[model samples]
Target: MTSGDVSLETVTAAKAGDRKALEDVLAGLQDRIYSLAMRVLVNPDDAGEATQEILIQILTKLSTFRGESALSTWAYQIAVRHILNARKLRDRDLGLTFEMFATDLETGLVADPPAAPDQALLLNELRISCTMAMLLCLTLELRLAYVLGDVFEMDHAEASRILELTPAAYRKRLSRARAEVIAFTSQHCGLVSNQAKCSCPRRLPAALKSGRIRSGSYPNSAGASVDYAAAKQQIASVVDDLKTFKLQQAVPGQMCPEDIRGRLTRMLSHPL
Candidate 1:
């Protein structure tokens, strides 16, 4: 749910110990929290764990939420802070560098790739997985800058506030992130340039054989069928490099599994 969907009355009630209102408040923010975490962390398991911890932090601090900013902004600020510190506290590392990722993209590419299989959304899986994987190459700070500033299309002021940076500082970080991403994609990704060696179709076979994507098991498929060429053409039609990355925002938000979600709510009652 969007921030606009969460009412001020609900926030007030939640802050005042209304259980139902607390649930509503957290519910409105969960998907957004998960989405941001997924983009920054690039692992479903990591994002899920992060979402739970972030939500719990929000819950504990709900009373202090003075409402000076929008609830979504407050929530996002909390999420960003938590994720940035989480790596240090937990010793978590994805260990991806741009040079390594560039090599990975070029590896196992099919020069004359066979036709994309039409069975249950393999192409979409490959497309989404590759795009998400690309973000892993960036440092967490830059990745968050790109996800908040570009993928979500958040306003500069709002994004800066969430990132807790001055507007100029935020812009500089985003510029660096945008430049790094655009430079890599422009030279390598077929969606940004036809001359690029790696297209989704060319990568599909290696992805399947490597067990990166199993056939018909993608949990978040959006369409009955995906036209690889059409999608590439549509994304490539945009002339701007930064704008081209925006088109890749089709990666669906990750959600917590039901059992984990239920456990999150139970935290309120159990106080763990």
Candidate 2:
């Protein structure tokens, strides 16, 4: 859904008060909005609320579509704006910085953590949550740059447009983000560096103790195993400094709540 996945006919139909056509358009945007929100917000509850707000804006603003940009890009621009300017989530209230996060990572390490039969799944969940948390260490601007340019692999032109920045400015932001993230991971994450102290198994005990990940709270499928060795190999298999972003991107996106669709459907019954 890069430029214009939604057809002009559909956009026109949506703008003209066609309920079915509008749902079609909104459905296409839902997963993407939710995914972006999840990355930016980290907390599921926060991401879900932000997703709904962004979708409502898109729904109310559908008539403003001029077709100058891809519908996806236009909607993404809205999402990026909301994320950058939105109020902070509870998890973010900690004001996590790289230095503080580094210390936190070092605080809990179990040489022989408790073992579970579902060890693979536990590691996968930890990998997802831990990597997602890393993005919080960056400022909103830097995080968006890293997610769009580095994680999602969007072109500089498109990413810059979405971020409302010049290509050069976006590039510089991404470069700084890339360097900062890479330095942190390479120095503290065992997945990207042999010298790092944190490993999924080593941190699992602390994570559970701290309620970072609770029993029965794992997403349907957290993701494939991402032990330090396997994650390191996965990174080595990709281009440089993508280890963190690759892991971040691999976490399954939050599914848009079904009630959102129903709510929007009911809204269509009223005057816009």
Candidate 3:
């Protein structure tokens, strides 16, 4: 899954002390691991540290691979769990609710785009900025479940496994998350809904001036899209109404500050 080649054999080999198999699994998962952290932590620097810790945890626990879950699923469990704990200790709450978002949007306190070039590159930066900031507004648990289940398009069972919750509990979390986010966007966020005044294009100028996104590397290379049809079924129509739009799945490029594999591998070379 993600980038890791999945097979019963690789899991068995990894469990049987095959270092190469373990490395291979990590190699395939490195991007996804960082990507998850980027979404959960909402800060690239924190995400980098979380990736290092997650890899180490996986490495130390490789022998315990029970095969009940896919290797990627197991890895994701470690990542999400670790992030939840880290966020609790760090106290980085977004303090956002539907009320706040609606108020901000209706009052026009959100992004104030200045004069700037209207290009796809600038648009990418705006998307990244708005999405990341919006994620910050949600509660920690809600944000993780929403990202895993909705944005990344992980099924309920798989997302639940990663969150170490039963299917029912996970489903409720995901539903609530989707409802709140969808309702807010329907009334506010310009990315998916129309009522709100702020959109990515309108905000890119201000983001550029504040150094939120750099000029170069602002535009992300076109990425393959994930199927959110299942998540769509769970969420209401606000997101599904978007046609050929990137809002549902597109994230800003350059959200990750470093190459996850390189950073973690380098960290592993050092002693505790």
C-alpha RMSD (angstroms) for model 2: 2.6
Residue-wise C-alpha lDDT for candidate 2, range 1-272, written one tens digit per residue: 23366778888988998888888888788888887887777777778888888998998998998888889899999999888777665335457899999999889799888887767666777877888888899988898898888777899999999999999999999999989998898888767666789987898888889988776667623544445446656776776567766656565556777776678777778867
Stretch of 10 with least lDDT, candidate 2: 220-229
TM-score for each predicted model, relative to the true structure: 0.91, 0.90, 0.76
TM-score: which is higher, 2 or 3?
2
Best by lDDT: 2
lDDT of 3 by residue, 1-272 (tens): 22235576776676666666666667767677878887767666677878778888887887777777777888898887788777553565557666765554344333554544546555655555556666666788888888888788888888998888999999999888877776666656665655567665565555565676666654332342322232223233434434212454655323334466666556545442
lDDT of 1 by residue, 35-101 (tens): 8887788777888888888989988998888878888899999999998887552477758887888
Give lDDT: candidate 2, residue 57: 90
Over 4 Å off, model 3: 1-4, 87-89, 94-118, 217-246, 252-259, 266-272
State the displacement of the C-alpha of residue 109, model 2, in Å, after optimal TM-score superposition.
Answer: 0.7
lDDT rank, highest first? 2, 1, 3
